[model samples]
Target: MTIPKDKMLEMLHFLMLSRRFEEALTDLCRIEGKIPGMMILCTGQEAVGVGMVAALRPEDVIITNHRSHAHLLTKGADPKVLMAEIYGKRTGCNKGKSGTLHLALPEIGAPCTSTVVGAGPPIAVGRAFAQQYRNEPGITVCFVGDGATGEGSFHEALNLASLWRLPVIFVCENNRYAGAQRQEEHTRIENIADRAAGYRMPGVVVDGNDAMSVYTTALDARARAAAGEGPTLIECKTYRWRGHGESDPQLYQPKEEIAAWRALCPVARMRDAVRARGLISAEDLKAMEARVETLVQEAIRFAEESPYPEPHEALEDVYA
Candidate 1:
């Protein structure tokens, strides 16, 4: 499963972009107070989003959890529009109606995002069922946190997806924490993927920090689903470098653990791997970083310059 150098570079670029974008949002919230809503930064888990989404076609749909900035960016959603949405601007992807946690970009195949725990899997199952009924070849991807495994909806959705042989990939971004509680304290199972056996589907755990590893695993899962072999549960063992959200005190996570995971920074790891392979030069890496910085600045500017939605327009999109 040797990924091409060009594709690896692209992954690296997206990883950097996601990280920088989150950082920009954090700065806005903490320093400028420009962003109006809560944010969950995927600082360390960029690899999982970049790797998995890169393997999918443009038509493939992705359903995401609350921590969705990485997923949306990887799915080709406009960063400026996302930033505007965070700022509650009218030019946002959802017309500034839904903020960070409830982004909806249908044009890019990321129809909607949910802030509720474990709610995305069932929705993903419904989307996959519709595709199956319509004889559509597109697949659905449901991104869930490790904590989602404990939810009844998660198990029920898996059961139904397996029963119908739905073309949905259940991706558990196991960051080892469900909100403030650690995984060991909440769940009896060692690996979340182990539960896949109960549903009669293939389950595999991959190094979520390694982008290429996740990419290859996603390729195999996509192949299996395309062949009607049923849904696959992929548990990506990764960690979040930031708190659960912007305002969380993060009292539960130890400083040592945070430092250790920071040492395993996925962006730096990919950059080193690419440079060591001579696929990209030091100059190339620097240039890429410069470009990402410029892009992040542009997104910030776009969000700031964008106008807020008119008060009268809120009633226009409402169905009730």
Candidate 2:
């Protein structure tokens, strides 16, 4: 399916906005100490978030790991709410009860955030099973890191998702590292997508830095899921420009590697791609950036002014 130039530009702007927000958050975490001592960043993976979100309906669900601010923003969740939540404000999503590590926006079907590495896939598979059994058209998308795939639950979830043909898409943001360990050090497979063959499912690897490519691939996966073709495993070859978490020193990755990946920034690439079509002007791109900046500033102001959760509210929502 061909996307109109305008829509492509819009998607590019969204990717840019998500990237900007994440970049701002990294700064916020450092100077402002807004985030906890440790925070994982999704810096260079804007295309995966923007592209994947573009392919989903509002009612379709997304389940992701701790590094999900970009996904949340792409799904149209309020940045104010996100900032507030990060600040543990009562006005934030989940009443600010959950931190950056555990966000949930059921209104947009992003049920929850998992900080437990590979935990999200099974939860997403469960949601997929429920949707399929109820004959609902919605699909669940689960994200895991290259490191998470090493866990036992990753294989277990893959087996279940395939055996039942659950309407879910398993997306592995293979940034080539699980914390500080390079992916090659932990696995022998050339491509993470190749693992899908064991489950008898289709797996595709795409340039995760290309927004259109990621969107097209995710759209196809969702369509296949809706048509009862089960799940698809998508390995998005991307990189995170930041350390694994805010507290991490990141001495393992070479400086040259970071420089090389930074050159592939998804938002910048998408902007260039859209401009090359001659459908968008330089002024239009500037306007989009200005708007995103204003929105982010407002989000910061709102989060800064928002009230923290009441001291007595800690007893709530613990029934699990």
Candidate whose lDDT is highest: 1
Cα-based lDDT at residue 168, candidate 1: 92
| CA displacement after TM-score superposition, residue 157 of candidate 2 (Å) | 1.2
lDDT of 1 by residue, 55-132 (tens): 998878999988898888989988899989989999999988998989999899999698789999999999999888
The sequence of per-residue lDDT tens digits that candidate 2 reaches over residues 1-320 is 78777669768868877877877787888876565546677888888888888889977999988889888888888888988888778888988777788889988889889999999988998999999999998999998888988888988999999999999999998888898889889899979999999999998999999889999999999999999999999999999888888778889989999999999989889888888888778898788889999988998899889888778899898798
lDDT of each: 0.91, 0.87
lDDT of 1 at 234: 99
Measured over all alpha carbons after superposition, the RMSD of each candidate to the real structure, in angstroms, is 1.0, 1.4
Using all chains and alpha carbons, the TM-scores for the candidates as numbered come to 0.98, 0.96
Candidate 2 segments whose C-alpha is farther than 4 A from its true place:
none
lDDT of 1 at 65: 81
List residue ranges in candidate 1 displaced over 4 A. Answer: none
